[model samples]
Target: MKTVILRSQALQGATASDLSAAVQYLIGVDGGGTGTRVRLSDRDGVLLGQGESGPSALGQGAEQAWRHIQQAVQAAAAQAGLGELDLSRCAIGLGLSGTGVEAQVEAFSALQPGYALVALDNDGFTTLLGAHGGEPGAVVAAGTGTIGEGLRRNGERAYISGWGWVCGDEGSGAWLGLKAMRHAQQALDGRAEAGALARAVWAVAGQDRATILAWCAAAGQHGYASLAPLVFDHAPNDPVAAGFVADAVSELERLAHALDPQAELPLALCGSIALRLSSEFSGTIRARCVSPRGDSAEGALHLVRSALQR
Candidate 1:
């Protein structure tokens, strides 16, 4: 069996041994629009295994999220050499996307699988918890979606962005992809120059107006997000792609500013898009960014541990 090692500082000094003896396992789940990732550990915080599965974003559906989470948990159990996990003997913590919606949260919580204990929060908050090891700081996570959260010294918390892809989540992969599609549409109409970005988007979205319309009809958040890599790949040579990257960087910077207007809290950039665009950030913001101590999954573990202590 493969052994997993997590960042030591984040996992140190937090022994879940004091939890109920019946709680033999600690499972941390980080679920987003892109996928669900699970980190399995013994109660004592020893890493056991890690597993990943398809999207578990609550916006996708509460039932679908649970199914994906269960699949990931089972995979983690198998990787740990455990035949099957006993939910009743485990405590689970989840950091998931779309937890901002009260109805979705309620729906997902209603389906809890009999775990001994549970703690849940949006992925942005969990990312903040992990980035700072539960300290006062801020994080802007830009992946399939985008969110900014900050913890102040007075125990106050602030959230910025994270409005989801339909109307918000600027600087996200899906947002980038949406912008790329717009560029392609304009190019196809001859309203804009047909550059490399337009050509690439057309290749995936279809070359003709009818086919493009058909593609857009079915291109949900995830489908549109699938085109984000093209933007990144062409940014080096394509002005349109480069402009999108510039806009994304600015959007993320705005999130940081909104999260901590005073800019006092340490800031950590999380998620694939955030990391990829980090270097492109303005010098001031770049200087303020710090590497995260852990990730959302680890923060979920911390969440349940705190819950158990209370």
Candidate 2:
């Protein structure tokens, strides 16, 4: 793969007359573990319509995910009043979670003929691009998992965390949820004092300790991670919940430190959980970041536009 480097300002201004002229339709898709989102825009970047579907990416299986993407694009196009839009003349931008892997890439490549021009990359890459307005910068992503990436002024790159939920992702929603569950179990078993964390878990899983245990036994890391919002909701008056937040912030800070301690540039806090905790976590992460200019959908569009220009 060839690396495409552009000045931050230049990247933001990228366009393609050829692609634009052929584009009676344009679609940007952001496919992740949680779900998929589609955005339709005109040649000039005017928003036309949007749609959503369940997770879509090769890692989730090519046929199934592609079906979802097809449905989403069709819905968006229909809403945009371009019901019979030709895929052959459409410019497509896909930010897909699993496509970075070789097998996944091959699967995506096999499906490329479905559209005029298609660009596929890991969803995180596009998220960073959109968060920074196509600028060279960094992002800390804390959702079901945690990861950080940076693009230096010289076009070099650095990364931290993102080892996955079990061994890494220390500050992620899955981590926090796991901690909360452990605390709850410990409290029930008389190994620890019953605290706010226990109460929060019980409230979400039900009041019975046995029910909570059963839920934990059946659920995977992602299921546990789903409880993070409950933890945050209880944090204001709950010391244990507050501690979880503190620890999450500390882990995020570690990720930031691993990138460049002294380097001062825009850092974006992305992903569902990170976006929610930005105010609290920003202080812990040291260098403050700017609000995301857009989400991964916009970033996918930005990348597609840049690629066409090149």
TM-score of each: 0.92, 0.81
Q: Candidate 1 on 1-310: residue-level lDDT in tens?
A: 0111221232234465534565788988899998999999997999999999999999999999999999999999999999799787788888888888888887887787677777888888878888899999999999999999888999888888989998999999999999999999999999999999999999898999999999999988898889899999999999989999999999999889888888898899999999999888888888788999999999888877776665
* CA lDDT, candidate 2, residue 149: 73
Which ten-residue region of model 1 has the weakest summed lDDT? 1-10
Overall lDDT per candidate, in order of appearance: 0.87, 0.74
Which residue pairs collide, candidate 2? none
Distance from true location, Cα of 107 in model 1, Å: 1.2
Model 2 Cα lDDT, one tens digit per residue, 1-310: 2222222222234355644565555678888655789998887888888989877755557876778888888888888888856776677888776554677677756655456567776677778778888888888887877778777888776767766566677888888889888888888788977877687787777666779878977766567788888789878888888888888887887787777676576888898888777777556454567778998899988877776666
TM-score of 2: 0.81
